[model samples]
Target: LCLALQDRLEKVEKEVQSLKGENLALKLVLEEKKTFASVVKDGEVEVDSWKVVAASATKCTLKRHSAVDLNNRFSTLSDEIRDCGQTRVMSTVIKTVLLLAPAYVYLYINAVYSLKSSHLHYREPLTDLVSQMQETSTAVQNSTNGGHPSTSVYRALEIDHTKASHSLWSEDAQCSKFLVNFGKNIEGTLLLSFPRSGNTWTRYLLEGATGIFTSSVFNDPSLTKAGFLGEVSSLSHNNTIVTKYHFLQKNHHATDPCILLIRNPIRAIASLWAFKIVTSWDVKHVAVIDNSRYNTSEFRNFYQNMLNRWMDVIRNALENSRLRLLPMYYEQLREDPIKEVRRMLNFLRLKPNEERLVCVARHITGKMKGGQKKFNPYTKNEMNQAQEAVKIVNNLLVKRGLPPLPDYSKYEN
Candidate 1:
């Protein structure tokens, strides 16, 4: 019975092993099928995604190409339109010019022939007409002289000096008569002259002489004043009694003293020219006043005109006994400043302050700290021009009953 039991046990073990092996094989087969199915599904999804990406990329490329073509067409259209408009404008301008060509030619010919005939014949009426024409042309040339409104030629011609009489004295002569009254009130006052002259320098000297005053008193604290005249006018009207104005103008109070300061015309012209350069002036439509047709020659003529104007002013001032104009030479101021200052103080009826006189000398010499070097306007060429101008001025001065300028030959060297 034991032998039979052992045999049965061994058979049972073999059956269990066989069953285990079968189960393992089935599990392996199922796993292999699952892996294969998963791989196939993933590959299908990838292929579909790639196809979609390709279709979308192609569509975007086509859209971009269409946009580029549209832009090119628009640009081409714009260029064509611009070209057409330009061509039309050019055609119109050409037609207009052609139509007016004959009229312009006729006018130019008439003007030239008339001018030539007037010059050739000594006909008084024709000469007068020519003069009027010349004046008109000059007015046109200097239309933008001061950047002011252009004065018409017709208006200029119509401006008859006889009809537009300038009164010697106006009803508001109270202000105009200031210098006359000044001589009575102030013991002695210096009458400074020059249209953009070194009136500021004269004021500085006056301030230095007073020593009790500041530079701020002499210099324009607010740049509202046009010039020394304007400043004085304001002060006189405002009743500011600190210091008096050096420069004189029309409509001054009758009670003010007058001390006239004069500079060499050529030097004054050069100084003005330099000032104009640093501060640009209106130069459009400059009149060609030069006899030589060169720019330098024209500048020389302009300088002469300025000198002539200055001479006229000087003569008028000197002749006016009521104004009590005391002429002071710029050269004298430079050479013997202290002596001149004292002389000026005496003329103004003020006692000479020696300390103040010293300060004036120092200020003018630019010896003070932070003082600027004086601007010298004369050059070699300018010196030559000045000599020529002075000769003419000397002749005018003699004619106007004034002494001629001292020989400036010593200064030329």
Candidate 2:
């Protein structure tokens, strides 16, 4: 028992030495931790932090970042987010433009095509309509015959005078007439005639033959009541067979064809004075008055003034008119009414109907003609002045390749 006790004491001493060595090691480790903490507070030591990166379910790695490195990483992450947002917005804008591109392109192409077609439609000549109608009729006839066209071709017929019918203009003796609306498809002609140049009578003949209304610049109630339905219509409306205008000074740019009716100044002035005196100064009177009643010295100064005016109107028209001109004489119209009417219609691009023309021939002298002949109201000097004016107009007409006026000294119409 003594020996066993001794052995146990030795073992206890060995264990106490081992414990002292362990305590010394632990104190060294604590001192090292305190020194490191103090160094950190003094900014002499840098600290590193680790992040775990999982490669797989069973595998992992550590990633370390310092404070400065962490801030750089966050800044890089924020920049990536901002860039992604900007890229998404730009992509959306590109997609939207792409979606609308086809529609904008289609609209631009369609507008260009429509503008070109409209120009072509308006610029086409009005005379082409007749050929187009004929072609359409021929095509339809051929189609109806099942590609075996007729041997007899369709053709437009000339005016046949043998065909007889009642008047298409009026049913009564008052020259009251029916008129078709002059549609937009037909272009207009200008009837330029000076005052008292048988313009009213010519309008009567035109309406009788064509059954189309003639428009006047002045809206005279008397003439309107006497079948001038388009008297009040505007000239720019362009819906009449002929529009009467005495003054073309402001309308020098008119492209319409003109029918300039000329009359002997002596007779025209005499007839105008008689008509004005009879109708109380209404210049648009449609009535034929007694010329012998007003043939006196009162016509001397008026005749000179009217002769100058007559020359001025003719000179202005010949100088300023830009389109085709058909110069007509009232005496010629009085002599051959049917021929003159047909000539006028042809110039207007209208096909004359024979039945209506026959009616015009039958009523050549209208109700306005009475039982009296016109008297000469001009003096010998006035007559000489009228001849000189005619000579000047005739020279101008010859220069323009138009026919000259007849000898007015012997005119008896």
Candidate 3:
């Protein structure tokens, strides 16, 4: 019976060992389930089955899990790549805009203000909009007192006239009514004369009467003398004025009933000499008795020679049949400008405008100031020399039906 009990104990012990081994296997399986649950919760794997096989099972389940993980990684990498590409494109566009911003702003402001300024706009080709804008600007400028519209208009007209050829005098063959009545049909009237022959005074008197003379007229001395030519040229071209001044060199397309103003040769020489001395401060030191300078010899020879030359120029100018060379003495202009001017008006076939005559008279006389006094009487030697000169000049005057100069001896008192 004791031997039977020992065998039973051994059997009991073996059974206990078996139960422990089973329990350990269950624990391992529970631990594995917990780990797998955690991994699955973290999105590492998805399981098709929970069967635990050891020796006979292949690694198919793990391999399947690895493939799923690889696919997920590929999708994440692809999404990241797409997002990076979009970010790069946006960044490139923003950088381009930043680089061009300054130049764009500069161009915009310049177009609006500087490029559209009035002077700049005038240079642009005329469009419908630009034309309307210019008209409005001109109107506004005219309305404003300080805008100087007249000056601007005058400048524009002057520039246009300057670019035009001045030789267009014969383009219009219309004759003046006065020239028609005077038994002549010519293109234009010319006031012919030598240089420094009171031309400025005459122009001043004529222009001042019309209230057209301004400070600009006399600002430049050279222009003050020749400015009348330009003025009359412009007026003649526009058919505004009937008469004009020609310095004799530019004689083209003659007109009838023109006037000539002549001076006493002796007085003209004296005036010119005085002018030269006063202006140049250079005394002419050549001996008048022996020097051939300026055709001077003794005062007598010079006077007679000058008178002859004067007559020749006048005669040559008178040869033009279209010209009505009215040779008026300079003394007549000084002594009685009104009567002389009236005679000139009558020759011009113009009714003497009393207001214009009065204005002209005032202007000529008003210019004679304190400094324009007559020269002192000739010296004893000068008087004797002048007396001889007067005799020769008087003979020529008498030959031309002009009054002879009085003897200087009679004026010694």
Candidate 4:
């Protein structure tokens, strides 16, 4: 009994020592937390104090104090703060760009629009000034010719056929008083002819009589300089009265009215050859056919091919087209200017004053008249070929109830 009592006293003393050590640690923890005079129990210590837990069935552990790990927590918190700051900066940059982008685009477009408007505003007055200058020059020139006040004055007076007798006979047609069909709501007439068939000379007469410009698919600088202003105009026929077209297949006016101007194939071929020789075959040159090249194998071959082409064009026009055709013979036009001009005007639905008709008669023989060949340029065999082509083409014309071509004796002896 005494030994058991002594053992109990030693155990009580060890527990008292443990309790005293824990009490010191509790005071230290309270001091760190800045707590004054904090009460500690026998078994419990202050917050985050290093201590051991009592366990009977499992292992007990001594845990580290919360305050002791302050350095590690501070390092982790600094990294999180840096990441959050970077994220906020990036978000601000993206939002600023998105908000400003549309404003920048709008400013750029507005600047361009303002510049274009300013340019057009400045350009309009300069155009008007140029046009006024041209009109004034034309008026001054008309005053010098035949005591006419102005071109417009004479034209307006001539349009009123009742007062045309009182109107001054002004030769302004030679000065290319013809107007282009720009913005005019009129369909065009196709003036179809083969090469070297007096197409240019006919155009000069036509424009003089009608006071309207003619156009061509070809941009002939020669004709343009000769006052055919619509030479380089649009091929759509929206800007010209009559368009000269050589190829029948290339005719855009399939259903439109056509004026088929026929000339002797032999004369046309001979004239074309002379033209090629004089102008070096450049279509842009205006050349009168003189006795330049003749009676060669080259001429013979060219005649054969061109004669076939001439026959083919005539055949195609008569066979394929259902449009109203006003066939004009080149020979008949050369014979009488007044009669042919009146007939042509009737066909084209135009009424010209007698004063303009007199002016057209005065300017009948244009500057482009080819030099007359006194003798037949073709050889015996070539003449036969040309005669055969003419016979065939004339028969085709007569069968279609069209006028037969006049005698082709201009090129013949």
Candidate 5:
């Protein structure tokens, strides 16, 4: 660019020099045409030293004073004009040099943008490369965890939690059979809820929100293959499980954080009766009721059993400092599920942005949602007794710095 401007400047200088030469030639011609002409016209002899005729057909004439010196002033002005032209050009060049960085930057940006526009067809390849990088990362993780069979039932989604060094299954041979050592272990989070108190619904909610499967610590035949500590516990420390009971370890084992899902005691007892008596799911109660001290009436038996279980679990959690227990209410879950689930996620130290739809619809109860023949069958006296039992438990819980149980008398028959 500088070279081009230099050439242009040279051309301008040549034109200026040519104009100066023409002016000089005209001065010489006027000097050569100077004639002394005396005219006796006014009584005194007045003289004109030079008169120059025009060279063009327009009849323009030039008059020159013989004594007036104009060359010095005219030449000085011509030289200043030449000097001004050179100064202006030099100023422009200096400014251009100072702004070169910005000029280069502008050109570079345009060039890059043009190239990108022309190569728009390569977008798919770039996308594919990003996908491949992600797939490679996932493959590396799977390999680090010991490769599972392609037909492996292990899930793709997982809850990330800190793992405790201890195991739930002690040295028992039966429990030891489930221990598998395929990969790194993580201490799992415990999803605890009183049975028949939205436990199943909470499990489903966690699964749908996190895309991770919750395993049962119970050796339920359905989840037998779903153990987490490889073969021993269905809950692998690498994942979180929603279990009904804390495993009966010798001195209580340290594991992941626990979330307790509970409901108003009255409703919970009613649901327990439905599970044990009406549905006969509590086989221990159903199978050995005749041989035990439990009341002959299943409602009374379930109420007493579940209440004791509730107090035991809550008291245990309260006493154990290592147990990080987050208590969630079933009524709150049923009323505004999203808010409760978000609270649970925050408790687990997990991001609630995982999924907004908890998929609790499957476990939602309707007006007629009872175990076999169910209704508001408890009398006011029975309801009052149940309320009092819950109050005693709540009083103790409050003294222990835990939350009180809600009154569920409204749910009584």
Candidate 6:
């Protein structure tokens, strides 16, 4: 009897110790919840602590409901226990077990309450966190798109992070099903510029210097046998394929090195306008400003919009280390075409042969021989508007350590 009594005492002592620990934890949680509830009522929430406060309030609300249900369940269970007269059949040891068991019961009830409260507490925050992630994903897509969602804009939509990137990578649209697919390869050199910035001329010069023909980055069937490519497939040295793109696009191969040809917006505006006369290439994904859209004859505002968009492209390009930038000005091309072509050849890692130099000379002569460019068409007021636009772009580029494109209004072509 003494041994049994002693065992009961030990069990009682252990329960007492456990109950105090559980009691303290519950007190702390409840206090935190109460504090949160008061803060919420006051209508001022610290941004960092807002989530915690919200969670605590939810937990407290859940705890209250759980406690009420638990109280009713215990009352019913106690009545049933007394009516069955089960307590009378117990031996002294069993009775002792029953006497010491309320602490365990209390612990069990508190655990269930805590678990329910905790579940309610975490749910809202988890939902908010997911909402925030979705918002960030959307922001990423829009920001990457320079301006509007189009083929020319380099878009990184939410779908890109999930499944679309995989689809783009695995399936090379350039290949016919009859021809074996050569898989996605992001290797090539990109000759990129704003439209009418001597991009085609540069491409021709680069071709002579490297003995490589250029392809359009876009998959126009008119440009190539393979229509609408995300990137040129092969990266082999034997391949003499350099690609040209009018604008920086979202799917453009970031892995390729680029030569950015910046022209004087004043002159480039005229050059772009004249391109209607010279070429008939079906370019895609580029924003073409219609001459009629300019509300004023000066077109300063019109050129300003293009300049702003171009700067955004340059800023995004600066962020990407993989897209190496080799900037050349159109004015520099006029200063010395041979030197510029040789410098570009160096960038492409190709040596110019006698035949190549001869070809380039012929190419430049042929361009010079072409019909007179829409020359001296703009009034002095129009020229001044262009110069003002150049100053805005120039000041911004100079600070960034990028070369400023010279205003060619004062100089003869």
lDDT of 5 by residue, 207-323 (tens): 545445455656554222222322234545454444445323323534446676766665666656544544333332222222232334765666667667765665565455544
Q: How accurate is candidate 6 locally (lDDT)?
A: 0.44
Name the regions of candidate 4 deviating beyond 4 angstroms.
1-183, 250-252, 280-292, 410-413
What's the lDDT for all of these models? Answer: 0.37, 0.53, 0.35, 0.53, 0.41, 0.44
Candidate 1 per-residue lDDT, tens place, 116-221, comes to 2322221222223223322323333322211223343321001212211111112333222211111111232334455444444555455445322212124442
Q: Which stretches of candidate 2 lie over 4 Å from their true place?
A: 1-181, 250-253, 280-297, 367-372
What does the lDDT read for residue 345 in candidate 2? 67
Cα error, residue 372 of model 6, in Å, equals: 4.9
Model 4 C-alpha lDDT per residue in residues 238-286, reported as the tens digit of each score: 5455788887774445677677888888778777777767744344234
Can you rank all candidates by lDDT, best first? 2, 4, 6, 5, 1, 3
Model 1 per-residue lDDT at 139: 33
lDDT of 2 by residue, 152-220 (tens): 433232332332222334564533343334434345677887787878778778877776667888877
Q: Which pairs of residues have clashing backbones in candidate 6?
A: 153-250, 154-249, 154-250, 155-250, 219-228
CA RMSD per model (angstroms)? 40.4, 41.8, 44.0, 41.7, 32.8, 27.4
Each model's TM-score? 0.38, 0.55, 0.36, 0.54, 0.45, 0.42
Q: What clash count goes with each model?
A: 21, 0, 0, 0, 14, 5
TM-score, predicted candidate 4 vs. hidden true structure: 0.54
Model 6, runs deviating above 4 Å: 1-187, 219-240, 249-255, 276-304, 313-315, 366-385, 407-410
